[model samples]
Target: MFISFEGIDGSGKSTQLSLLRDVLEAKGHSVITIREPGATLLSESIREILLSNKQTITSTAELLLFSSARTQLVEMIIEPALRDGKYILCDRYVDSTTAYQGYGRQLNMEHVELCNKIATRGVMPHVTFFIDVAYEQAQQRMQFTPGSAEPDRMERSGREFFERVREGYLAIAKSDPQRFVVIDGHRNREEIHADIVAYL
Candidate 1:
């Protein structure tokens, strides 16, 4: 089974993903975790470029860069793992492009979807979990404390952009009830984890 997790910048996706991986591994399932634009060496380089603010990128160009990363990840990691009957847990997949590019950047969603199909070669997740949180709440959680990592381009997109991102995720969740399960991110940590477990 392939499981994908999606959320805003500070929606506890990393934490929840960590817990989910541990739980699944404890159950003795063969599992591997892959974050898009990462997991592979070349893709990690691509990730740095994608997350930076070094250039003013067009929507089409942004979509293509992300798709290129997905293409590399799918070919080098995802396909091989799944072929060996390994359960793959991915953080941030093509839905991210749909939200960030398609809605937030006002790009053409159908074209983005087409690009994604080529990226993944038509491998869809068995289940996808979208952590639902308010844009304001996410911003508060994203505060850069002392010793904290610097904000990426997506993180610095401002509240209005995040609002559009929230809407994009909800729209995706609403469009596909069977594939996407949205969990309110305002809940306690344990509560959120439990909800994900229930959904799984």
Candidate 2:
């Protein structure tokens, strides 16, 4: 099973993905986890540059840079891992760009979707879990990382933009009930994990 977990920053995707992988593997299932824009070192470098505050680029530049990293990750990390018959869990997927860039940046969805297809070569998750959280709470969680000095670019997106991103997730979830599973991330870890497992 190829599963994708998505939401705005601090929606508990990481915790859930990690937990799910552990549970699935314990059941004798081989599992792989792929984070967006970063997996291998090369792709991680791209992720840093893309999320850095050092560069000044337009929204289109942002979209293209992200796509480039995704293309590399898909070819280098994901494709090979999937061919080995391992189940995959992704932190985020094309739905992120479609929501953030397409709706949040007000870019064209048709254009964005086409670009995603080319970048990922049509590889997508069979089950997408969107951790639902209120915009305010997500922003609040990102405000103070324990050891962090600053927020990453995506994390630093203002509440308004993040709200749009949240809306985008909702829209995607609504669009495909069969494939997309929206969960309330505000619950405790065990509760959320139970919900995800129940879905599977």
Candidate 3:
């Protein structure tokens, strides 16, 4: 089974993803956890460019660079791993592009969808968990976290942009309810993990 986790930054999705991976591995499943924009050498380079605060990248350029990184990840890592019948647990996937570029950046949604198709080449998760966290809480987590000494460019997108991205995530989930399992992000880690495992 292929699964993907989606949420805005500091939504606790990564924590949940890690917990899930551990649980699945304990159950004798071959869980392959991967983060987008960093699975391949080229993708990791693109990730640095995307997150760096030094250079000012245009909105269109940002979208294309992300697409390029995703394309490389899908072709080079994701597809082959799935062919080997491993359970892939991805930190983020196509929905992120839609939420960030399309909604947060106010880009064209239709164009964003098209770009995602080209980038992913039709590969999608069997199930996607959209961890629903309030924008205010997510922002607070980002700000107060110890390792977050310097906020990345995307993290500095501010409250309004993140609110829009949150809404975008909900809309995407609403449109594909079957493929998406929306979980409350406010709950305790163990509780949240229990809910997610129940779904599986």
The global C-alpha lDDT for each of the candidates, from Candidate 1 onward, is: 0.85, 0.85, 0.91
Candidate 1 residue-pair clash tally: 0
Model 3 pairs in collision: none
Clashing pairs in 2: none
What does the lDDT come to for candidate 3? 0.91
Q: Write the per-residue lDDT of candidate 3 for residues 1-200, one digit (tens) a residue.
A: 78999999998888899999999899999988889877889999999999999999999999999999999988988899899999999999999999999999999988999999999999999999998999888877778777666888898998899999999999998899999889999888899899999998
Ranking by TM-score: 3, 1, 2
Q: Name the candidate, 2 or 3, with the larger lDDT value.
A: 3
lDDT of 2: 0.85
What RMSD does each model have against the real structure?
Answer: 1.4, 1.4, 1.0
**Residue 121 Cα positional deviation in candidate 2, in Å, after optimal superposition:** 0.4
Q: Report the candidate with higher TM-score, 2 versus 3.
A: 3
Which regions of candidate 3 fall more than 4 Å away from where they truly are? Answer: none
For each candidate, give its TM-score against the true structure.
Answer: 0.94, 0.94, 0.97
How far does residue 187 in candidate 1 sit from its true spot (Å)? 0.7
Instruction: Quote model 3's TM-score.
Output: 0.97
- On TM-score, the leading prediction is 3
Cα displacement (angstroms), candidate 2, residue 42, comes to 2.9
Q: For model 1, what is the C-alpha lDDT against the true structure?
A: 0.85
lDDT per residue, candidate 2, 1-200, as tens digits?
67899988887888899999999989999888889878878778889998898877678888887888888888887888888988989898888898889888878888888889998898888899999988777766666547755787777778888888888888888888889888988888899999999989
